[model samples]
Target: MKHILNTLIIGSLIAATASSCTAKFEDINSEPYRPGDLSADDYALGSAMNNLAGCVVSSDVNTAQFTDCLMGGPLGGYFADSNANWKATISFFNATDDWTRVFLKSDKVLPVLFSNLSVVEVVSQNTSNPVPLAIAQIIKVAAMHRVADTYGPIPYSKIGADGSITTPYDSEEMVYNKFFEELNSAIAVLNEHPNDRLTATADYIYQGDIQKWIRFANSLKLRLAMRIVNAAPDKAREMAEAAVDPQFGGVIEQNADNAAWTYFSGSVNNPLFVAKEYNHEGSKTGGDTHVAADIIAYMNGYDDPRREKYFVKSEWTGIDYVGMRRSAKVPELKTIGRKYSGINLSPNSPLYWMNAAEVSFLRAEAEAVYGFNMGGEAKTFYENGIRLSFEQWQADGVDEYLAKETKKSISYVDPNEGINSYDKELTNITVKWDESATPEQKQERIIIQKWIANWLLGNEAWADYRRTGYPHLLPATEEGNKSGGVVDSNRGARRMPYPVAEYNDNAENIEYAVNTYLGGRDDMSRDLWWAKKK
Candidate 1:
């Protein structure tokens, strides 16, 4: 929440070096004053690129816990916090500025991205190849879009411009349009330099694979296109069509082409693994996050083969893959919730940026709903998404799994406390694609599978839930509805309130963003620009 200008000033100082020596002294002290004096190609641009990659999904443990595990994961119905102390936070529909501010903090997404982007730009200027700058642009969109999605309007397109402390907020529509433009420009540049490996050592996602970067940029464009469909249908169709047209470049279609940030053995551990399985005592069980009941119910009912891949079995008596329901009392949560299944990630696992399965599902929706040419029919893309997810997890029985037309999400049973249990099936949606199904049902099918495939990428899942109302996530319990009637218990929290620091520092812009751009009060209950009511 610190002013972007302050962060930019600090970053610029760190990036620049002082050369105080006169011409005569320079001849004697021929060595450059700092690393910045090195040739642009010799500068540590890879480190800047790697940091940008880490910021995409956040490799830091605490940041991951705050932004992903405690907020997006539960809100998206993927995982719930097992630590009872956090029950009053966003997981319970309550917006705590202390916790929510971490997403926008100078150390988190925005400042780090803008700073590193500046470094990339300055370093890449002397080089003729545009791949580094283009990749940085793609990374900028990848990282900042999450920030924009978290809060409706964000200080984008003008963060470091003119170096003003009171940065203006861009409307959600404006932010998304800028994202499209950045992706288009980056993809064009990368396409021109198809074999450029200028960013290989610095690139953690694809090791400077320009083709993969182009594919990811296109895939990202497709995602944003779908995100804005409800708000701007014509533009959404135009961008989505352009994304998969193959003339510019193809979208992510194979598992090998998936975009992810890998964890170097000694440098940084996977943050999700640390947040979910590593504790202060260096043990796994007491970590804060556990699989949420919604995912468990859906997977259990389907008899999903990937359960073993997704979660470790619960240590509690008579429970296999039981999940902790949201909003359990502190006493029950601390005592029993700790025994629920934790996420099955390891410290060395790669944090995914985007995957082929998600892209396939996007194509499936575009084809089914918008009648776009996604290189195949809806069923083909839908089935391919399932197959790709299974393959990604190394799970078996995909052939049999796709044939499942009868299984649906089963009822959630809390063996320890019936108060947390749901008696009815979560949803009646099935696995196999049905040609005669209504448009809504088809969309549900595609999104449900997409949600399952998008495990741990909770922000995207949350966005999809808000946009399409798919997977029919279980509503937060009465105890979890802590928004004082502002947020609907059934609908859940829509967007995080603007950072409290913005109110204290940039009061005028915050007011303008709320009144003019948000078109509603600055609260968690209001729907974002892309959010459609079910």
Candidate 2:
């Protein structure tokens, strides 16, 4: 393979430490050399693939804690940081550059993805098989779209084009278009080579199962389609319909076909597990991360069985599954937050990319809200989503769970501090799908169930919260609104601002992005192109 030396600039941005990969590849812990330096025979496709996989949601403990736990998890209402020091950060709608920048920076998502993709492109060109490149494209869209969603305009279409640091930013709308184009191209290529196993040993998500990859791509397409429904309804309907069409291969509809990054050995641990269950010394403690009040309230009210699978009972309250309130005082966070329920996960737990349960809910939303042909009725898909979620977690009581019509999210009471408690029931939406309900109500039901099913995938949950405004999340407590009036306490942050590094490194392009595409300010208060209007 002809190595491209120019891409090393991007690689330099990524940490040189070895990534935690699946044990099937014995050399998984070998340090990642610059992508441009690898020769044809020396190229480690498995390592590159693993690195790409890890960067999607980040298998690294610190990266995951920062991007997911501190930022997306709190904003998405799935988690809250138990660390009192973080009260002024993204968890409370204050977008600190240090906290919010991780999602955009080298350690987590973009630089590593683009670098590996460049190497994969060269490999595809030298070899006749197109499988690896197709798979790489799918991974790129999966990872980069999250970056785009987090920050409105990003260096998408132009990254690594000529190895320039000052790549132009693409508008969120344009970025979504490029995502569709890439997914379409990838789906076409994979469909042609349905039996290809060129990257089988290197594939961590699906083991180079071409058919499964195709399904994942379609499911990703459906997700992107639903994301843009409010922003671009016509295009969203067209893409959503195309995604589920059998002729173009099908979306993930079975639990067996779920897409996730798996770690075979204990040395390479799941990030969420590490963040919530174990301390830095690998000893068990009241972890720095805890389940958020919003999710626990919703689940507790419905008596959801998945709570047992998703979180452990609070240490202070022994029997109750308490969660930390985002707006709690620093003293409460230091004392009560640590006692709140931590995530119920093990070191080897696989981090999900997408699952059948989420797909079923997406189809439900498409059918119920958009009136699209999803091969089933909206209520059927909605209930199926709940059922699949129960099965995914090995939780029982599905029949009774789905039959309940009156159970709704209950009020949150901070046992330690009554002032922090929210006594009024937040949402009236129930578990059972109501066919007679309006389209908006049905959408709420679909998204609420979807949010519940997407337990640890906080980034997706945050995006859904922005897109549909369902599962009414509690605002950060008055003390937690540290945005200096840039963000509303009630509405929360709309999107993360561009990292300061972007402004320092690529001033011209960043300026243009803010001026032309991002409404003249790189502020978290600004809504993304796909977000529901305030």
Each candidate's TM vs. the true structure?
0.91, 0.91
State each model's CA lDDT, in order.
0.78, 0.78
Residue range with the least summed lDDT across 10 consecutive positions in model 2: 13-22
Error of 1 at 220 (Å): 0.3
- lDDT digits (tens) for residues 1-534 of candidate 2: 134542442243222423332232343433444434554422456666776777788876787878788778888998876665554578666656787887677444665676666656655665666788888889888988888888888887877722344688888899999999999999999999887885434677887788999999999999999999888989999999999999999999899999998754647677777677533222122456778889999999899999999987776654468777775564334445545676788777889999999999999999998888888999889999999999999999999999998885487876565656888878888888788999988988889889999999999999998888878888877687777788887777789887888888999999999999877988888888889633
Q: What is the C-alpha RMSD of each candidate to the true structure, in Å?
A: 6.4, 4.0
Question: Which pairs clash inside model 1?
Answer: none
What C-alpha lDDT, on a 0 to 100 scale, does residue 104 get in candidate 1? 70
